[model samples]
Target: MTTNDPAGDPAAARGNAARARSFGAVAAAYDAGRPTFPSEALTWILGPGRGLQVLDLGAGTGKLAAVAAELGHHVIAVDPSPEMLEVCRRRQGIDTMVGAAESIPLAHGSVDAVIVGQAFHWFDHARALPEIARVLRPNGVLGLLWNDADTVVPWVRRISQVMQGDCQTVTHSGGGDRFEPMPILEGSNLFWMIEQARFRHWQDLDRKGLRQLALSHSAVAILKETRREQVLEQIDQIYEHTARPPEPLRMPYLTDCFRAHPSEFANYRRTLDSPVAPHL
Candidate 1:
């Protein structure tokens, strides 16, 4: 399978692709810096389904996959970056594949549920939606999750501002806007009955951990060395102003989740075309 670039401009498409692949360079930092999805959010997305085969689409460093496996779901984690997959491979019980959301390597109707974490916005959703629909069984669910900074706090808001800069490139590229309804899911005809949930969570991190988190962002990771250092220094200054050193800093987050089932008409067609007995 191949991804068709949705952006009309060649330069824009190239830039988007570069940003998507940039995380591989800081795969270790990404794994260490990123916050795991709240367990409550995961429970809500997966429901009470047991022993289900779940595909963690674009599963960076196996964060979501690890949690799913712990919940007794069989997980196949796929990503386009080998560097990210290398980290995922070290985690026991996660099946890692090198692939993208637009062109998943999984077979048709092979997964009971498909979950994307922090990477859906980077996909060419025009192509990815169909591919995702193809891999899901009838009535299978699609779940998208993002861990956004709880900027309701003044200090947290300031830190976020520093990290994002004037253009808000980091948030734009990193799937920000946790509170708003996802336009892609809303406009998509392939999925329906969308529902959303939010969970409040916090991560305790030291200065180094905080810096790693900032550096893991694609916008920050791709910066030239001098600019990157400047950004890090800014982040450090913000951290120092917000909290004392040697003490763990509390980073608040809102774990936003959206889950929906494949559209009825699409699933019906898939069922009719299935090799086995018709679902209906």
Candidate 2:
């Protein structure tokens, strides 16, 4: 959820929004390139529960939702992009809706859990947090998931550098040594505690898949035709140098999962504040 730009920069904010929205144009590429969440991570996120109603907020292509559904939970997948939701709709056991985090479509206390996969960074926490707190049932869990390239590996470090234009490197979030509480969650007094877990996984990629991976990036996807091609070429060059013949390249990822529980007081307040439907 960390960005290289300063928080107060208006241009950076605009650029980030553009990047966030850029995925719809390359939704297919994103589905092909993005790795699925490890089952262990989802299991941990859901705790020891079963058959809970799960809402995959900001659910791009239903990656996390599909896994949650497979694990026996009914999943509601919500995203703002029609193109992305189209891909998500193809998945079984998932109900798709077009919505944003700032304004969730579900009723208050409607869902047992809310999971956001690789999309929490895009949210306006001030607004989204309250909406999230509203939809969550009492004792409901809020989970945030991210898959970061394990740059601790030597060659993967080079790939991250290439992806970020070689000027700066991507920083790991959630599972790093320093444990800083998220200000939005902590200050809101809606959540009682924050707990995190890390899982390791690998994605196998061929040359075509590698190209798709580069094309899927918002920063690269939004580039003009020629500049985008240049970035792809650089990425291909790295692939050629690092990848071995007859063996698919194994890209390592650290799936960082975080879960927070709603405070009893917050749940009680939301219940009291909720509007009732009129009796006919």
Candidate 3:
């Protein structure tokens, strides 16, 4: 397929194709295989904007919620998958809610801050932004984050190419680097925090486990089960071709975060039109 205006409409195309991109196929593996954000990065995104209560939007497998809770902030975790939520529920003293970023289940202006991990790219930002803006208190903040493999590593590059399927370009744009560009949301998402961090640790996962992690991505989630199985087999070949010891391999990622607030209207409109963050 071709488009007349790919540059002006990349995001639109992404959104249109994103619905079928499955995120739950490897929910369990995602929880198990995905790395957590670094302490310094978390501090950068949320430390300065500490609030009375924090919400972790798209709190997949409770990764962000875990860190948010450590900050001693009252944290609420929200996601659309029961399987993913199940992993989050394992965390003690954590509040887990079943909701989408576009339709969070929290009350208006009821949160001090909202943060998301590795999942914001999957959201319909045009709608999610306004929804998020409505829920933030005056100068309240919103944070977004993701952990992507450092494919600059030769082996990692091959692995990504094999598993990314048809989405390699869209998903791996800019070398899988971390991004927190908040300007796109200027009218809606005002900048509050900007940070970049990297994690170099590795996990011991077999070809099957590594394949499972890729399958969990929303992009791969759109494939038919049979075709997905074929993708996994192909991924296995790539893994075998790359691994030296030919056993479980470790994956490394650089995590990035973006924090911002809802844009406020003019001085006169503020008094009557001050927006309230939504809870629904």
Candidate 4:
């Protein structure tokens, strides 16, 4: 099975893989610090579907899976990390499994839709695209979601800079390009009818919550002990200097959501090969 590690630069990709896996070490903090998906965003992705069988691929700590379950979807949550899966299992509705995006554990043509939230960038798209297409039914939907800080707000911009170390990390992390059409999805024949939407939302967080949020990031989570402490201290200073007297400060976000359906070719192929009659 192909790993989620990035390609091209071997050393950098290995470091990224290690960084990606580092989340399990701070899984609890991740769950606590991460903001949940907006209901409107979920509604847009679901698109009038009810009780759909949905797979949450790369579902770290069940954040998006929990939201999907609440919306009455039959949710299956999958991730590579056992620690992340453990947290997911604790949630009442989701069925948790240990699996990577490139090699989903589910049977072929089973799920009505596959949703990936905040983790699609880590996927090896060459392998994962085929796997995702395999499990999705004819005309099945593929949704991608990302919760990004709205740096247009000056304080939020400054805070993001502090967390990211520099503006380049923000750009490299797809902060600016997330809302645009994804190259992998756009260039592929597997998916057609691509659509995009942005939902505005904000989270109320205190100084401690802000610290946890910073720590929840892979870049921050992978930092060495003393360096991590220094980063947190910098965040603390930023919060102290900018936040008002109110205990909970407003942190704005833009939830970028994109959805696409299987291409006509994909649907036709599935129809010809399917053991059961095509649903679409």
Candidate 5:
């Protein structure tokens, strides 16, 4: 069944597509404001390996792709936005391509692992999952990750509420000590042996950086001029109230990582002549 076009609210789908593409306009703020993935979190996703061909699908600004390359993997970063890919290209040791998850630009069985960072929710899973499976070699891995604010702290929780105004626009996986697995992965014939892990990390943000953080959000970036200004003003007030004298605010994040392998990897070799075995 294809999911690229679904029977749902047309307006909502259009809004989602618009929000998904909104980051390219504020690419600089996204790079500056967003926190990098923890090396340990990435290592866990890639499993025990080096020199593997890894594809960072839906990679934005190469945040996750850059870290994967540093870990000794041959990384290729792919995204739909050329503007975002431009920033990704500046980084060393990784190739950048303009592509989307629904239709990937790679050879069949070309990559050992495929990773998505904070971008899977934007994909049409029915189309993307099969495309992703097609590109993986035998026993390959697929990892999905998101970085969320640790809202267990009172101040941090308050900041989160402020950022999420009357209308919810930002999307987050999980916060604090909690991790919520995606419902899309629950019972799919395409994948199996799904596992999850979380890594704790921190980012230091000054007042200007805090504003950039707000601007980095798709909802805030697309807001009408006056309302956008109001949001920025609110962020400044929050910073003034939360900041300690002369020190940047330490923002904690819980990085949620999920990894799975194609069902074919478990019982079949993805060969045209090989008979598929049942998954046990």
Candidate 6:
């Protein structure tokens, strides 16, 4: 028998295993094309801080680390990609290391909170959760987040359909596989069934930038050069469709936030299932 980690679906995780092992060329373009989290989500996760010792897991480009620092927290960024870490190192106020969700190198019980940006879907959460729980001070928060394009807009949705058409698994999460059915955390613990938030941003690109973004994807770069070119051409065609006559193309995003607290509540379950019974 085989099992997939934290947030991946069973069959999907099997399909994704080989591709998940490396993120070489996708590093830079991921930083470029991806959107950052909203300030509100950060505050909701970090709170109006006295000060926080935070971990940015799968901290690609130190983007969230940069944000956490701005919020007056001590931040450490971790990722497995050296090429990705090189870009992260250039960013100010971030302490970076080579690591992944499955095996974190930091000491046990070291952080006040952990924030996982768009990379949660890639983790083995069973391994990661215990490791994360170990490193976090008791009652510390864990935030899992993503910044997906706000594809509710007709053009934006159409663009996403084109960009992701070949990809079988469109929805994502690291929390998806691990945390559900434990308890559906509510009120503060859950967001509505559908949620959206917007930010205005611009990116300038040459063909190289375009290629960088294309290469950043796990799916696109995994293919051969001819196949890669075919996909790239398809992407360009889609972008051309979106551009009205003459307009520089830019994508829009709605940062989605999912936050959870490790409950002191789990102990109650163990107690009920305990072999020794106490009179009620």
List CA RMSD, all candidates: 4.2, 3.5, 4.7, 3.8, 5.0, 7.6
Alpha carbon lDDT at 231, candidate 1: 88
**CA lDDT, every model vs. true structure:** 0.80, 0.81, 0.65, 0.81, 0.79, 0.63
Task: Kindly list the per-residue Cα lDDT of model 2 for residues 115-172, writing each as its tens digit.
Answer: 9998877776667888888888887899988888888888777766666663242232
* Tens-place lDDT digits, model 4, residues 1-280: 1222244457655765777898999998898888889988988988766788899999999999999998899999999999888888999889988999989998778899999998887776777887888788875899999899888888887777766764243223424433233657866688988898889998999888889898888878877899889989999998998888676888888888899988877666666666533433
What C-alpha lDDT does candidate 5 achieve relative to the native structure? 0.79
For model 3, the local distance difference test gives 0.65
Model 5, position 69, has a per-residue lDDT of 93
Q: lDDT by residue for model 6 over 14-126, one digit each (tens)?
A: 65655665465667777775555666678877788747888999898777888888888888899888887888888877889999888988765577778988776677655
Residue-wise lDDT of candidate 1 within 1-280, one digit each (tens)? 1123335356656776887888899999999998998877888998876688899999989999998888888899999999999999998888999998889997778888899888776777777888888889876889988888888788788777766664363224333333233566657677888998879889998888889998888777778899889989988988888887667899998777899888976686566666422222
**Error at 191, model 2, angstroms:** 1.0
Which portions of model 2 show Cα errors greater than 4 Å?
A: 1-9, 166-181, 275-280
Alpha-carbon error at 20 in model 3, in Å?
6.2
Q: Candidate 6: which stretches are off by over 4 Å?
A: 1-11, 170-211, 244-250, 265-280
lDDT for predicted candidate 6 compared with the true structure: 0.63
Q: What ranges in model 4 sit over 4 Å off? A: 1-12, 170-181, 268-280
What is candidate 1's CA lDDT for residue 265?
A: 67
lDDT for residue 261 in candidate 1, whole number 0-100: 89
Listed in order, each prediction's TM-score against the native is: 0.89, 0.90, 0.78, 0.90, 0.88, 0.75
lDDT of 5 by residue, 127-151 (tens): 7877888777767889998888888
Superposition TM-score, candidate 2 onto the true structure = 0.90
